[model samples]
Target: MGKRFENKVVVITGAGGVLCNAFAAAFAEEGAKVALLDINEEAVMQNARMLTEKGCTAKGYKADVLDQESLKQTRERVNADLGTCDILINGAGGNNKRATTDNEFHDFDLPEDTKTFFDLDKSGFEFVFNLNFLGTVIPTQVFAADMMGKKGANIINISSMNAFTPLTKIPAYSGAKAAVSNLTQWLAVYFSKTGIRCNAIAPGFLVSNQNRALLFDADGKPTARTEKILRNTPMGRFGEADELLGGLFFLADEQQSSFVNGVILPIDGGFSAYSGV
Candidate 1:
């Protein structure tokens, strides 16, 4: 196939993170002008530098997904630098330690240090929820404006497998991702008339910088949760970040998926299908 995204302007939030950085590189390789947006200025800039070194058109922008003004400003810069946006990947969302409970289930007379759902910090819960949910919304509101009434315009939200089935001890992340999935459907319907397809990919357990510690111990042994995840997954292994690119490419390519919309595609290792029976 020729360059699928030649001259196309693809913008991705959370591009500083491992998964989204890979997405940026893939888009750049496909001849798209990739704009990497992240709050971590240094990280995104380094990623952009690496891609540019490889002769790809890419630039990094320091953007806060929760801040509409910041995104709007970044949108102007992206528009001026690389033309209008053809595809937007809402890849900015994550969990926080404060929002996550210490134990799977609450028990009476638990240790004071043990954080139950009731003990969850309100600020942390709001931060996590807003980051995943509002983070998707604010950016779309700003960037999708350029896509209005334009053919081949689309939005891809990064949801989590927990969105389909809530995981224990991380209620905030699960709930936020679930909301993102729902918003994807809502956006699809809302933008159908405008020719902007909206969809989401709910990733399974992936070992990335953000979750590496959770998956592995200092001794490099699999953690308890990692073992449980593998046991539940039919594929019996965690997914690689690059493994998600195909689904994203399919969704972003208008000709390939013209009729695909409001779909929450799961890139899990059949984890959603298993029942532990």
Candidate 2:
């Protein structure tokens, strides 16, 4: 069978990170010219080098998702280097340790060092919120300009399981991702007339370097949080980052999902369905 994305230009933000880096590789293997954008210069450059060495047409660019000017400049470079983006993946988002509460529930006699809802840093909250919500907004504003009239142009935003129902101790992240999910629908309707489709993928508990400590102990035993997650997940396991590829590929390929728009497809192994009942 012919490659699905042959000759397409795919741009992914947060391409330096593990999940998005995997996405970059997948797109390249599908015959797309991939553009990896990340705030970390060294990380993105190294990833780009690896892809290029593998004979994939890929390049990395340094661009902060929150900075419009940085994104504009990166867009110019991407157009010159890879052509206007046909698929834009707004994957640059994350939570902050300071913004999260130490305990899921409030304790009147909590330790002084313990962070609570009241103890959450305002700056940290803003950083996390902006990184996820505004980060998605700004990148779409900059790159969607190029996709205005292009055939099969679309955007994929990253939402989280916290979006559907807020997770404990992560108010900022939950709120921010909820905004992302809402924005996905709004963008779809707004761009429906402009020929640019918008949708999102909400992933469940996937253990990565970012949350390894929270999920498992140094001795490789499951943490309390991990147990809770597994119990709630109908699949009784954490999802693999590679497992998200099927949903992504379905949404990005116009021939397959031309009629699918404004949907928040969850790749969470039934986490959203099981209500602990």
lDDT of 2 by residue, 169-212 (tens): 89999999999999999999999998899999999999888889
Q: By TM-score, how accurate is candidate 1? A: 0.98
Per-residue lDDT of candidate 1, residues 1-277 (tens digit): 7798999999999999999999999999999999999999999999999999999999999999998988899999999999999999999999999898888878888897887888889999999999999999999999999998888999999999989999998999999999999999999999999999999999998998778888899999998999999999999999998899999999999989999999999999999999988
Strongest candidate by lDDT: 2
CA shift of 176, model 1, Å: 0.2
lDDT measured at residue 57 in model 1 versus the true structure, 0 to 100: 100
Screening candidate 1 with a backbone cut-off below 3 angstroms (N, C-alpha, C), the clashing residue pairs are: none
Q: Root-mean-square deviation of each candidate, in angstroms?
A: 1.0, 0.9
Clashes of 2: 0
List TM-scores for all candidates, in order. Answer: 0.98, 0.98
Q: How does residue 51 of candidate 2 score in lDDT?
A: 93
